[model samples]
Target: MKEYPIMFTAEMVRAILDGRKTQTRRCGDRWAKVRPGDRMWVKETWCWCWKCARLNDPEWYHSHDEDDPSIQLDKCGVKYAADSNNAFETCDPMNPKTRKEEFKWQPSIFMPRWASRITLEVVGNRSERVHDISREDCIAEGCPSQDWYRVNGGPEKWFMVLWCNINGKKPGRSWADNPLVHAIEFKRVKP
Candidate 1:
């Protein structure tokens, strides 16, 4: 039952959502009891939002049996239609046929403003090295031939995925060889 002293600020909360701020402390008379204005160390691994924390809570999770229907609602205030009658049709954004003709030429890709650029480092052999570059730099460097994908709605995480065309060969002899495309799990840097 460790305790943490966390001072909640709007900007810090925003930074946490943006993946810029990694750690937070929770202050109270319980747990790691401390006086006011005192700081508590928090590990990035322990930092999670209410939703994620709840989902991962063992006691609450294993005991819960009911489904929350509100989870299906879209941001636009539309509910999924249960009937197949087509009587309550809502505009589907994915339907290309219904899209405006004028906007047909525009790509359907949705890029976010936060991670338009991401710097990736290559830490291996030069011959096998794919490339060390940022997301924005890669996009600009490759021009029209560049490929990208979007990771839609999920926990407040830094959504970024950059790909390089590695000819059918794998970069490293071992599974952990390629440092360029390594998957780094998001852990709130402790403070």
Candidate 2:
């Protein structure tokens, strides 16, 4: 089967890890070609330890030495953003006293397959209008608790808010616009 890389926000990664997420919806036909048994490597925000990179691959490290030296490298390899909040931070090298917190975590889009810790196998796929999302699908898409839904005016409302937040900026992709989307269902698999 074919393998693909999928990006997830830290919150979605947490939901997947907690077994609360099993499906994802993408605007347009982005995931329409995905089929059952195809594998997807989840790419979340991550950061590599500079010290470890330099020690392991001196040549590669030397070639890209833009990493700040002040950033602490407690781990030996890549650290996923979903694993913890304590990520490396950069301090002012010139002024050691200046402690502006700049996270070292790279964007999920830039993550490489080798650094991924979660894999998913597509179990089902379908296409439907964004507004056609059901309450069950919302839960599968990692909707929060009942209490959260109550606060946010139920599951569909919550999903709409989230959808708008992520896709509203794109033309004809807003929740109100109700664009067609690909609904991809998946189950966690071995990395």
Candidate 3:
């Protein structure tokens, strides 16, 4: 199967890591290339350790020149060093003592497939209006369970917040306007 790189915001990454998100929508030119049966490497901007950076190796990194052929990548594509006892460190911007070997706040688009901890298999895809999102689909999009019970916008409200936050507040870009969106349903692929 063909593999593609997909970018997501930090918040969306958290949702997916929680095992609550299974669907996503892509717009503009990015959606045209994706299809069912294709594998997607989820990319998110974040911090990582030197080892992690070496394993991911997304082009911007070059600090670690050494390579270990024995290390293996998990299904999520993360490679753990042999001596770390399966434990590794991640870059924490909040931490002031961070070392040079750490990678911090890198953009998701630059994330390499090897460093990705998430993979998705597209099971279905369709084009629909942003306003056409249903409550069920909202859940699939990774809305919090509590929002589902809200009497007002409920799940749709959550999605609206995310959409605007990600796509920006540009005119004519909103769910209320029912703009065209490419909806993709996917299942988590074990690493």
Who wins the TM-score comparison?
A: 2
Minimal lDDT window, size 10, model 1: 106-115
Clashes of each: 8, 0, 1
Order candidates by lDDT, high to low: 2, 3, 1
Instruction: Count backbone clashes in candidate 1.
Output: 8
Model 1 misplaced stretches (Cα beyond 4 Å): 1-8, 31-71, 74-191
lDDT of 2 by residue, 118-137 (tens): 99999999999988989999
TM-score of each predicted structure versus truth: 0.19, 0.80, 0.71
List the pairs of residues colliding in candidate 1: 3-32, 4-26, 5-25, 5-26, 6-25, 6-26, 6-27, 44-188
Q: Which digits, one per residue and each the tens of the lDDT, describe model 1 over residues 1-191?
A: 22232322333333443554332222122422333333333211111122322433468656654234332232122111111121223445354543332111111122121111211221111122223333443332222221222343222111212121222233442223433332111233332
What's the TM for model 2? 0.80
Show model 3 residue runs off by greater than 4 Å.
51-103, 147-153, 170-172
- The TM-score-based order of candidates, best leading, equals 2, 3, 1
Model 1 local distance difference test score = 0.27
